[model samples]
Target: MSDHTIPHIGAAWREVVADLFEMTKPKVVLVMLITVWVGMALTPIGAIPWLAVIAGNIGIAALAGAGAAFNHILDEHIDQKMARTHKRPVATGRISRRAGLSFAGFLSVFGFSVLMIFTNALTAWLTLFSMVGYALVYTAYLKRATPQNIVIGGLAGAMPPLLGWTAITGHVMGLPLLLVLIIFAWTPPHFWALAIHRRDDYARAKIPMMPVTHGIAFTRIQVWLYSWLLLSVSMLPVALGALGGIYALSALLLGARFLQWSYWLLYEKKPDAPWGMFKYSISYLMILFIMMLVDHFTWSWLVSIIFPNI
Candidate 1:
């Protein structure tokens, strides 16, 4: 191969890989995995199944990626009409619709196989359900059909921690449900913040996002309402004794900050970019889950020291 040809080949290969990865929407998958990992770690059970943790991460990432790819394929037309997403691989024709569908199928099959093999059937099934709910239901129908789309579709996105818990515990539990509720409540404010920032993009695409459908004021009020509810829901775990002071304190403080941000978004002078709350919402969930993980280990260590034996 000629030297120039070699660099061309390398560039082509990099572009191909990048397009494929972009179809999966890896940034969203990262937060999903963190929630799953934290849920796995915080399982109150026998010695941690290290294998399940590793396998669960891989499986969840694959399925989440698959679902995102499916979304790309479904939303390509609308994506092209939006400033924020016009350059998506599928939208821009870098990845063909047929190719995107194939990739999504491959990821789903691989993820499902890994989940069934490494974890339990229930975990695999639940993950599959969430993926389908997002890719098929949310992306295809809910997004176009209603302004309340994210609020309802958020259930699918909120399942990760529960998936993680079931991977390790082989059964669902109350605490994991609490995790799901917190995320479900958080998703609205998170998404509505971005929707406010991108309301024009949504309008251009003819998608009925909250800000586009109900107007910015109504959407802003919804963000505040959901953020307040999220703050209350986040405390449920600590209140019920699933978590202790460290986690509870952290949840309260972080949630207070989230509410404060929501307040600014709703009440303060309008800014050029209205995505401040969107950025903080992501960090809020990540840190809140991390606090829960830390609380679990801290409690475990204290118990081991204080009790020493039954």
Candidate 2:
């Protein structure tokens, strides 16, 4: 081959390699990491250990990616039925099952080692369980067995924040559980919105998503109801004295907007679109976590400056 042809071939191979990496669903892993980071940030002013934070986030992200890869492998048949996922590397045969599972095993082992070495053993073990919960219990079983799949399976997805908190504190506590609860409440609406758009695909796959099992009307009502529940849960931080005015104000506004949009989704004769809500749900969670960080830092500073004697 000519020199120019060699370069072109190299670029093509690199693109294929990139496509393989996409199988791990890195963007979803990043969202999980963001929550973990925020959870670490929420530790009382002097409690955070930066080294553990870094190690824990990296390890958790790797395991989360491994779990996602397992999901891709297990859902391959159903994945092929959905237009959105039909081209996945595993589904398209660009990645073989043995290769995919091997990659997942490698990631899981490496992630576990890092967490055990750099963070506490508690964090390492909990994160390992989360990976199994998401990949085996949620993806392989609950997802196919129930229309309430996302609702029940969401526990695995909601665990990163708690893992993050424990990484820092080396123990479990109420605040971390509250964060888990907030994410748990947010999961159904976040996912069901997309499920609405893909109802036909799910029906064809026999996956029993909410829209497939309960019909769109019922699913929309559930979304609206869950949005309200999420809003109520968002305020618990303020009520419990865990967060401050900044988080309170931000949560109220974000949750209200979420509730309003969900109401429109429920009652509108023909709603504008549900995809935007799906997209916004991702943004909403990230922003909510940011507000928590902002609240903690700013409020802690304010309290110190305003009432030095206290």
Candidate 3:
């Protein structure tokens, strides 16, 4: 082959590999895995099946990543138009549509098989649902159809804790439901803050994000409203005795900070303000979940120390 053809083939191979890796949406999967692990750790049951947990988490992460990959495939056209997404493998012509789809399919199959073989059928089924929700319903329909898309699509994102909870217990309960509710409520504010910052990019892509379709002022109001709702939802675990005072205090403090940031976004019309809130929202969720995990272990250790007889 000529030198020019050699370079083209080498670049094609590199792009194919990168596209395959990107199918996993590794960063998002990492956070999801952490939250799921927290759920597994916090469950009142003793002696979780370590291998099962690991396998299940890997499967969940793969499913999430594959779903995101498929999203990129489906959204490549719009992605090409959006400044933030134009350089993605699919959008940039680094990977072909067929290649992206095949990689996504492979990951999805592998993930589902792992969950089915190593974990319960329910978890596998739920994971499949989440994959389809994100890849098909959310990406193909909700993303451009309506501003309320995230609200509806957030259910899939909120399922991780429950997936983890059920991975161990094989059933859902009030406590795990509370985790789901917290994430569900948190999603709008968490995403809208970013959407506000990326509104122009979204508009340029002809995507109807809330900030693009309904105006930034309206989106700001929704962000603040959802922030308050998330704060209230975060308190449920403590109220229901699923968590102790330490968790309660931490949740309250974090919730306050989250609300403060939302309030800042609501009032601050400057372009940069939403970006700050957007970044904080990511940190807020991760920290809040970490605090919950910490509080769980701390309270259990204190109880053991104080009440040795029990």
Candidate 4:
């Protein structure tokens, strides 16, 4: 091919790759992958089966991406109206609705197939429920209908770790359920922080976010309430003897920081305060999960070193 043709072809290929990546909502998928990995690593019975774990991870990630894409599809009109979401692929018209929906369908089928074939039926079914919960119930209905959407819909987001636990053990138990509860409790404060910052955008889009409908003061109070609940929930592993004192200390410190930020967001009226709370909330959850995984592995290492017999 001529030099001019080569550059044209390369540009076209790059666009194609970009469009495909956009369909997967790559950043969100990355978060799902990390949490699932942490869940598998924190299991007490040594390393999980690699093949099943990897297969389940891929399926879960794909399903999450598909749901995000379908959300963009359903919310395209609203997204286009909101400054925060106006530049999304669907909203920008870079990807047609038909193409986006088709991609979503393909991803859902492939992901469900991987889960069923490589993992157990239970994992497969749970994953399917997660997809529907996010794509249909949360995105299509609850998001527009009520300010409590994320609270109800968070069950789907919180399922990844449980899915990972089940994929390894082929059953659910107290520990995995605790992990699920951690994410569930973490969800409201996390998203509410973002909604607090984006209240104007949500209001313009006519979505009934807590801050938009119930007013900022009410939403701020809810953020503080949820933050406290999350802190209590985070201590459960330590209380159950699943973790060591180190984990308890970490939880105390992290939860304190989380509450401090939420408290400021609740009481302060600074222009930058909402943004600060939003950033801190993400860090708060990420660090909490990281500390959990680290505490688990570190405690195990210490026991092995000190005992050297058991």
Give candidates' CA RMSD values in order: 1.3, 1.8, 2.3, 1.6
Model 1 poorest ten-residue lDDT run: 268-277
**Candidate 4 clashing pairs, residues 3+ apart or interchain:** none
> Rank by TM-score, descending?
1, 4, 2, 3
The local distance difference test score of each candidate is: 0.91, 0.89, 0.86, 0.85
lDDT of 1 by residue, 274-305 (tens): 57778888899899999988888999899999
- Mind giving the per-residue lDDT tens digits that candidate 2 earns over 1-310? 7889999999988976776688779888888888998888887647557799789888898889889989989999999999999999899988889989998899899999989999889999999999999999999999999998899999999999999988888898888899999999999998998998788898999998989988999999999999999999999989999998889999999998788778777876345547778888899999999899999989878988999987
**Which prediction has more favorable lDDT, 2 or 4?**
2
Query: What residue pairs clash in candidate 2, if any at all?
Result: none
lDDT of 1 at 158: 98
lDDT of 3: 0.86
Candidate 4 — what's its lDDT? Answer: 0.85
Candidate 4 per-residue lDDT, tens place, 80-199, comes to 998888888888988889989998998999999999899888888898898899999999999999999999989988888888877777788787788789889988888888888889
Q: List candidate 2 segments past 4 Å from native.
A: 1-9, 45-48, 307-310
**lDDT sort, best first:** 1, 2, 3, 4
Candidate 1 residue runs with Cα over 4 Å from true position: 1-3, 270-273
lDDT tens digits by residue: candidate 3, 178-254 = 89889899888888988988888898888889998899999999999988899899999988888888888888998
